[model samples]
Target: MAVSAGTVMPAAADTDPRGYLKIMKAQEMWKVADGTGITVAVIDSGVKLVPGLRSESVLPGVSFMEPPLEHPDQQYPPHDDFVGHGTTMTAAIVGDGSAGGPQGLAPGAKVMPIRTSIGTPMAFAAIGESAKGVRYAADNGAKIINLSIGGWWSLDKIRSAVEYAQSKGVLVFVAMGNEGDGNESANPIAALPGVFGVGAVDLTGEPLPSSSYGHATDLAAFGSKVQLRCTDNKGWCVADGGTSYATSLASASAALVWSAHPDWTANQVARVLIQTAGAPVDGSKRNDWVGYGVVRPRMVLLDRAGDPGAPDVDPLAAPAPAKTPTPSADQTSAAPRRAESAVAESGLSWQWPALGAVVAVSLGLGITVLVKRRRR
Candidate 1:
């Protein structure tokens, strides 16, 4: 499932400005589980040890981006947050606000960074890189995998890798996309079975326009106007709010719950998050807009509402019905579209947009952030 290193490329940045800790009420949850002994694998661009992150909070991980063989005797560390996107994600999950910055939801949690690709608005030049990255993280002792970046591509290799991680009791959280449409084809990784597809919401718990919606959408978090420090020290930057930030936050929240109850399986943690999520508007039990609702990990930590279900059971699996339903016209016509989407995933017909004004432009930096993942 490993892809060649040549496929990784450059992309853009995004953000908003706000104190997410206060909004999510993370202080209350900290009293119970500060996420000690938990490891979150940030499978994005490489993560650097930024100003606020301590040496222990960030750990070295593998890189699918192959290094040049010419430097056979040289050592290359996969710790460079080249485009700063990965650094932003790591900060949101484990930052301690030591350098006058926003604190992470799980300050005591460690981040194991795996660089599968580089830059914003980038795609998996080799789609199998994502698959390999997932497997590598799980095998290396990561309980939760946070993918703040995604694309329309989905390889059989990637699906198998995700299934493998699930079997090992690891939770993988992926961004639901930012196209403002519920197009599963646009963000194929989120459609995989057993993965938790996360979307974005505002402080008031309203879904953002860029947050994609679909059956894959499992949970939502405050992604709009989130504030954190940048790798270059140009000051704190605000992510314009997309599913990328939300997915990272959701992953950190899971670490808190997991750290509190070391014996709970991934299924039990997932069940607790779903049961504790704040109810959304339209409230039809479940919908494509925001799935279960905004993640409320505090409810499980303080209220002790996270009842560990069957250790081996998956809560996301639909119950078996007495009979199979007949295929409707919509279902019949969807076959051709699915085929078309498969073609799109492998092709470069779709293009991403440039970074917005809010994302601080690096001086002399030649990166052109595109419209994929959660930034668009």
Candidate 2:
């Protein structure tokens, strides 16, 4: 169930009031690269030209869903979405904050909206539609493909499509899931060898219980209490927790890194991200709960950390050393402490809400959480 929408709330004057940008040090990273010359294909329901995305930030793309008869005007095609899910994802990656909308992490980058059906009880044809979207994005000029949708099972068509994109040097990122438990075996796309399986964490840097985890979990990012611009409101809504948002951030992070080093290969960019990520408190290379710790693009953009290994080397292809889980830290009170300590050490202040004050929002209408399996 990756399509969980946040409750509509009063619009904020700016995204800076929220902690997501500050926690990731987005402002600092933007000084180096604003994602220029990068296009991230968002494969979801569709993308609407909201105020934040009004500029030429969104590019024309194909749609797999049949056009509704009522709105058959060729001028107004499938790029318009009634559901705000796709729009929200677009905003998270490249929204320009026009007219008080949420600002994107990589505002200078462009997005290609690939419309496809992602509602629950999804028809078998939906898989074909998604596969087609992936292939189309790869054939086009998309440097990165973002699939925030997930399903319960894996299929060859989607796997072949993902492989096709990877072979073409396109980086694909998928949501681990929002099952609220550790059983991520049900959703396989995130487990794909080359695709980045992103997980979520709260402002405190602790892993969200709802974020699915397993061998496929490659990296984690701030996904809880994230601000987004949805069709439900002219303003903004804060998604309580969903790997979909985390996946968007991960894609945006890649855009920032790629924009700064446009000549780097896809494998090189992937290598830098994994290498610069904050390691687990136990000092293991990675773990099931938070992968290689939270993504810290600033480490690469500002501090010049991480060596982009061999261009031809697929980092995930080699088996990583077995993770030594810190039972006391990862599973209990120690996790939050470790996160806070790390933040303090980095000289970053993260303002997280008190645990007692956390409130879950209601999902918007037509926002269905779908799960998909990986090709492995």
Candidate 3:
């Protein structure tokens, strides 16, 4: 519904220069106001209180490694980021669109950060840490949780955590890992039953050549050399080409739709993104690789007409019709507990991205999920 063309760094308030539209064009997303008051949890390296992000919007964040000030040397956890992947993803969701930056799809949405991995052993540890981080976010008030990283295993504890988060009415977004190199495996979060997995598409609206393929990738979005806000203060941040940025962007798009229609279930949100998405090559429909196709957040806003056919039923109200795997074998299995939220009283069936939404992430776990009455 909102549109703007930006030029140069530090562009005028009305003119956002970053081509991505959301991160650089702050006011643009605000005009439609689908994400006002919504909160997103960015489970990544860490958020450093960048410009235009609201202090009030920020909740207490955690990290496997201690804060930089506390651990000047290597004493802190090894999860401190060198790749800057998490920071770049954060800007795409909540950046103020400052100085020719890409405006996040939901600029008003606050971020809750959790830095779990930073490559190597610590990154491997993130496989376990992600379950903890997602659990924490759902326990709090995060409506949407974004995971731009992933790997190959699915642990029972992690499966339980995903189920718990969904029971609490949280929407999760995950990235299908990049396809380059020998790294070709099923991404974990994407493989999970409820998480929305994303893939990368270039500016030309084609799936990126580097995007890995798997059952986890449920949808695709712009990636490529697209730019967004950066912690580097350069006003032009290039997201590493892959589904990492795509997942983050999809999460922001979900924030926009959720903010506009808070009562809808997560399944409804997924249906909206799918039913409204624009097909670049063909008509609106699902493909093995692209799923329902590229997500068109604006369509969820109902600002446009005659795009994709709108679905009548909520896709996620009912659990997956198929059997979802659980990782009960691991001795380290400890699933996070979930507490019910306002969704139950509403009696609305919440939907989510189908199981195996784990394509774009960098880590994986093999685990089983079990259900039991949870106590608060």
Q: Please report the candidate that would top lDDT against the real structure.
A: 2
- Work out the TM-score per prediction: 0.76, 0.81, 0.69
The TM-score that candidate 2 achieves is 0.81
Best of the two (2, 3) by lDDT: 2
Kindly provide the TM-score of model 1 when superposed on the true structure, using C-alpha atoms. 0.76
lDDT of each: 0.62, 0.67, 0.54
How many clashes in each structure?
Answer: 14, 11, 52
Q: Report how far residue 337 has shifted in candidate 2, in Å.
A: 9.1
Q: Over the stretch 147-229, how does candidate 2's per-residue lDDT look in tens digits?
A: 77665333578888999998899999887666644333314666566888877777667767666666667777777765565
Q: What is the lDDT of residue 212 in candidate 1?
A: 61
Q: Give candidate 3 regions above 4 Å deviation.
A: 1-17, 22-29, 51-57, 65-82, 99-101, 180-185, 228-236, 280-284, 302-376
Per-residue lDDT of candidate 1, residues 278-354 (tens digit): 65444344555456677877778888876778777776765411221223566433321111111110000011112
lDDT of 3 at 129: 75
Query: How does model 2 fare in lDDT?
Result: 0.67
Predicted candidate 3 versus true structure: per-residue lDDT over 1-376, tens digit per residue? 0001122233343232244443223344456664777888887666555554445656666665423344556544222334345555676777665544445667778778877644323454565677888898899888888877665444666778878888887888877665522223345557677676676655445555455444455667666554533333334544333677778778888887778777767767776776666542433234323545666666556454222223333353344323222223351133111111100000000011111222233332231122211122
Ranking by lDDT: 2, 1, 3
Worst 10 residues of 2 by lDDT: 347-356
- By TM-score, the best candidate is 2
